[model samples]
Target: MENTKRKIIIVGGGITGLSAAFYTKKYFDERQIPIELTVIEKSPSFGGKIRTLLREDFIIERGPESFLARKMPIMTLVKELGLEDELTATNPQARTNYIVHKGKLHKMPPGLMLGIPTQLTPFMKTGLISPLGKIRAAMDLWLPKKKGMEDESLGHFIQRRLGKEVLDRITEPLLGGIYAGDTHSLSLQATFPHFSAMEKTHRSLIVGMLANKQKPAPSIAGLPEIAQKSMFLTFRNGMTTLVDRLLKELQTEHLITEQGVQTIVQEDGGYTVHLDNGQQIQADGLIMALPTQQTAKLLPNRSSIQWLERINYVSVANIALAFDEKEFTYPLDGSGFVIPRKEGRLLTACTWSSSKWLHTAPKGKVLLRCYVGRGGAEEWVQLSDEQLITAVLQELKEIMGIEAQPIFHEVTRLERSMPQYPVKHVEELRKVRADLAIHSPGVYLCGAGYEGVGIPDCIQQGKVAAEQLAAYLEL
Candidate 1:
């Protein structure tokens, strides 16, 4: 145990880096191993994308609003950090989501799971589909399972199983809203393999969902009540609460803000990290908890960078507007709305934040958060704050019929935030791991790049990286 003392340096102060620091501290502290930890963050603040904006009486999230609690690591961390009471669920009534078709908002029909209709009545009534389109969708019930193929695009799978209407109207918008990705390029194996398995097993997605309707839901510990009620959750304050709590629990010396790593050079039996501000730190182990592109920059000669560079990212802007509830003709109901690419709207998705959680806004006030720009839509990303707000306001006027101006408005841009999971994503990840093993040693990578993209996924990757590092150090 005395020999287990090792200095560790973690790059990036996002949730992944923070989680790694916290878990590593716990492991070493319990084992009586003397460990020194340091976390370097590029931004002045530590939360990274998990930023919460408080203006007047309204609480706005600059980045991700919530996490899907179905993943265990996030929930476990929340409990470990004592944030259980601060967590809240989305409004129960807001469980339903709306989709834009042609030029109007239509309720996404119930019983559909990720664009695959598990029930018949809802699919038949969903106005997004034409009568003939509904018939093509229903034909999936009798159609045989797709024969063996290595992999297929989400676009191709949905078009073959449920028809182009479902892919274009529902699945595309829902998935695109989440991933900000094109269905034509998204891989079913990497994105949503459960649907693929359903097709292979029951020969029909509807039959599989129906047959499993009575099965008990999967367990997710330490999730907020709303998460137990459903699968997703957000804090009443914002996603930043999770990061704040983790930072509070960990030692201050282990964390550093506004210090970005400029480069990494191997030296002696360890490594030396050069900082952008002309400083260097030596560490027995290093964890690069950054996006793939940033990691590529630090490892110029590594082949892993080529594959990491091939994995592209999309920029996004989340515009939050606060308005009086009396101004809206239609009551702000449901979670929010998603715009299908076919609708040709400048925005991607909008969330009724005030409705999604309690205490998000003042009395009689409503907060609407609109997400815009993805893939090739750099025009929206480049828009001035005023221009972006005006564009979103005009769209809201036509879609939700809100005519009044917002009393308060805020805009947040996430440049290259979402990683594109193309059809070759799996191959790229595999190559990355193989290349890293052959080249970089005593160095590891984690975050939304190689694995899942959700908050929980990041936490899980961080914890796994910590365990692997601990094992390598034999701590």
Candidate 2:
């Protein structure tokens, strides 16, 4: 008997891989395509970095905390999984974001969005920037926009257009903390092309942002309240809720975890994936939803994909400490504070989970998620648990003046987690995609390494890859 179903294997069962499987199955069903889906995960768990800890009445996230709340692809999947009711917005009361400057926490101005100022008054009044710095930043309005569209470093762009002061104090830390990257090397095009677009269109980043802010935003009208309230949102219980629901939707029949792929070889106009457990699977098509370098390693052809190997990664760690309200006396009204690279602090950023997410902690308990390690300063990620905790605690004490100990703490070390996008990343990736399309017709790549790093971004990438795979299979 001849089997008619096409064997489509999805490697790496993280959010991106899972999303790909989910969408592939959906698209196949919609198009009436005979498809058999399989998902392989090297880790013991399905959700790659999205680990959530539930202890007592606290919900702590070890990996990513929340994602941007916008009309992105994650919203559609959430609604499909019946998770719209579980969405949780950040606490409205905790509105401020502080920056560590001169060993003191300074409140970031109100009108700053992602460290770029939209309002002049608030930026000029900010304590984090000096009067001279503010004056330099104001020069952006008069500074002529760079003529060429050639790719440049984010640090260079910010410092060139605004000033070195804003880059060091605000934008660098705010954006750097997102990728655990040093903004100086991050590709302006690959990381945030919108910034470049603003410069090209308006000639002044500040004036452009101000104009964009002033434009009347489209009415939300009747969207869910949580979606309307804040720019970021997560599940009420934790981030794992999304993964759990995805598992239920996809079912465990197709998932294979705790199994690593030893190698992938082309066979019979398709592919044969060899697993570490001495098992082989035939695939008519493959959705390689893994790291860029890892995907390149598995492909048959060598030279074309070598550029992907150039993409670098950085290690990071996070410490989550739980405390009874009495133990945390210092006023932590804001969500948290970001430490600039110039501060020479091991800790990069700290999130007041209890204060930020009202649902994360019970009435009298507080949870703090402290970030550790970033580019050029990531050696501490390899520190022993005791040593790391002691050092972080001492720093927290010096910064916030809190002597009380946490009831309990958990540390998560994520090695090689953050993908670095150096200058020319966008163009390089485009060429690689073209090479894959020409050299390896049935193979595709999608994950944090290629386009985006956020959870929602990963989901979108998965959806896109699945759509492309579906189109290829139909052909």
Best candidate, lDDT: 2
- Summarize candidate 2's per-residue lDDT along 210-281 as a digit string, tens digits: 888999877664456678779899998889999998899889447899998889988777899999999999
Clashing pairs in 2: none
Model 1 over residues 162-194: C-alpha lDDT tens digits? 889888898888886677888787778888888
Best by TM-score: 2
For candidate 1, the lDDT comes to 0.82
